[model samples]
Target: MKSAPRSAVLHRMVMPGHTCPYGLKARHLLRSRGYEVEDHHLATREETDRFKAEHGVATTPQTFIDGVRIGGYDDLRRFFGLRVADPSATTYRPVIALFAMTALMAMAAGYAADGTVLSIRAGEWFVAFSMCALALLKLQNVEKFATMFLNYDLLAARWVPYARIYPFAEGLAGVLMVAGALHWVSVPVALFIGTIGAASVFKAVYLDRRELKCACVGGDSNVPLGFVSLTENLMMIAMAIWMLLAYGM
Candidate 1:
């Protein structure tokens, strides 16, 4: 006879005004993974708290397989040979999302400006928008960004203030480019930072072979230091050169 399918017991919070989305996700995961789930919904806050206290577990949406606790969603993923939960784990997802959104926004702006998406204007908008997005990420926590930047940036390591001011400079350049004004300010700023950033990334990642997290997305980002970081600097350099050639600055 064939063996019965494995069954799981899932205890999840479904209290009034507090439906745990993870609980639904866990249930979906269980069903998708070929597990018969016995979902135990805690319908009230008091009941949820009592369950947690009784079980000595910190959070809800807990799962059990074969009478052995498999933990929450992250734990369930691990139990099934999926990704493990580590808060500081490095990932490129955030940077990818930011860049993707920037591109889309630039495309939209291009269409709005002249009803054309395949023009040189679109490319300029893309680079300008990308700079703004990156600057915003760094500005979220300047202190944290500065700390991470110091790990690789030559000027930041020597002069701490440069790290603090980097985001503002990048943002200003981006805004000026977007407006098609103030080439005197934006051109120099973009060229200066771009040159320094490219050199720093190259020396640290290519020459020294140092493995480190990029501070481009944010100070607490998991984005690795390499191609993406180098690309951002290169884009700025290219944009600066393009602008100079166009306006003779």
Candidate 2:
């Protein structure tokens, strides 16, 4: 039997600025292959650039299987083909997007009044602020969001990362929403916001058996199987089905 080749991943671990999105996803992809992975986060732009120049890595998380560069996360995904997208293995980008969108939008609307799109409240700000967070999660792992309450977390503790970062970002969006910063057509804005969140949640869960994890209260979420959580995601799923049906129609 031919032995499996050893592999490693190197990611520049920095917060609030770096493109760790694709990098982390790549690492997760490699992890699924049972390879020896090593991640190195570039702390400074100079370091990252130097590493990039040194290794000819235009981006990260760059993959090295026995000292060979294989590009970033999407490349690795293609390398692993559809296998890494499986929850039973590694990589869950779709699921995370779905739940994250719904949760962030709901929290954003929480600080607004009926018919008043923008107000001097926290909820409004959170609505806008969630965009960046949403982008990051999708950039990392959408599959996890799709199958949060499934077999993936059974072997990993990051079913919920310790980073209570989402809640804080939501707070920022809520502040903006309430401050009436986004008062330019709030209803449609809210709906649009909700739609993105819904789509993210729907995609994530659908790819992972329609099972879901309740993304409430940020990282410390513990609201039980409440009606809102169930409906928010289900509505997203329904919307997705509608889109699919419309397209197929």
Candidate 3:
């Protein structure tokens, strides 16, 4: 003897201009869980509103199992023992991903140029690539980045325009470093910004004991302003010194 398959009823939005994503997800979930779904599409705004008002629910994609309401998509997920995301949780995933990607790029570049993945040049490339990537993120919205940067950067606080200019300087230095050219220009640029950045991060995070978001990844980023930020600046400073010693006469 075998038990019959579970059955579910789903009411979801399917408007002309906008189909509800949660509704689609709910339908998919029901099918995947071996439920025979009787899906009802509220195809118009009026119909959707009527459905909501009648059901006394504020949101759509409502589900029913065994003649009992199972609520919306999130509710359905909970019923299935799925993990729901916490919107306010802090994470270091962005910086971790950035560093990982840059390391891989550095290794690839090393292999392409010198026929080996591990070398002094690979280390240099890693720093240079990271600088370029960070600069790109900041450059996406310079004004936003400048606002966030002014919070901790001593130089930016004193000279407001430096906040805007910082990304370009970092990017130019990085490009030059990667090319192994124009050491005269790149070395000074990297040293100046890196020194100021390290000092600012140390003062804000260590000395002043303030917890804040990092502008290193960009203004909107949730990445914490602390060790990772300091490391970025230190790497830049070290790279500048290394390039100067290796190329400067």
Each candidate's TM vs. the true structure? 0.83, 0.32, 0.88
Error of 2 at 34 (Å): 1.3
The candidate 3 region of ten consecutive residues with least summed lDDT is 83-92
Q: What's the lDDT for residue 77 in model 2?
A: 70
State the weakest 10-residue window (summed lDDT) of model 2: 217-226
- Ranked by lDDT, top first: 3, 1, 2
Candidate 2 deviant stretches above 4 angstroms: 1-5, 15-19, 83-249
Where does candidate 3 stray beyond 4 Å? none
Q: Output the better candidate (1/2) by lDDT.
A: 1
Candidate 2 vs 3: which has more lDDT: 3
Candidate structures ordered by TM-score, highest first: 3, 1, 2
Model 2 / residue 50 / CA error / Å: 1.1
Query: All predictions: root-mean-square deviation over Cα?
Result: 3.2, 17.7, 2.2
Question: CA shift at 54, candidate 3, in angstroms?
Answer: 2.8
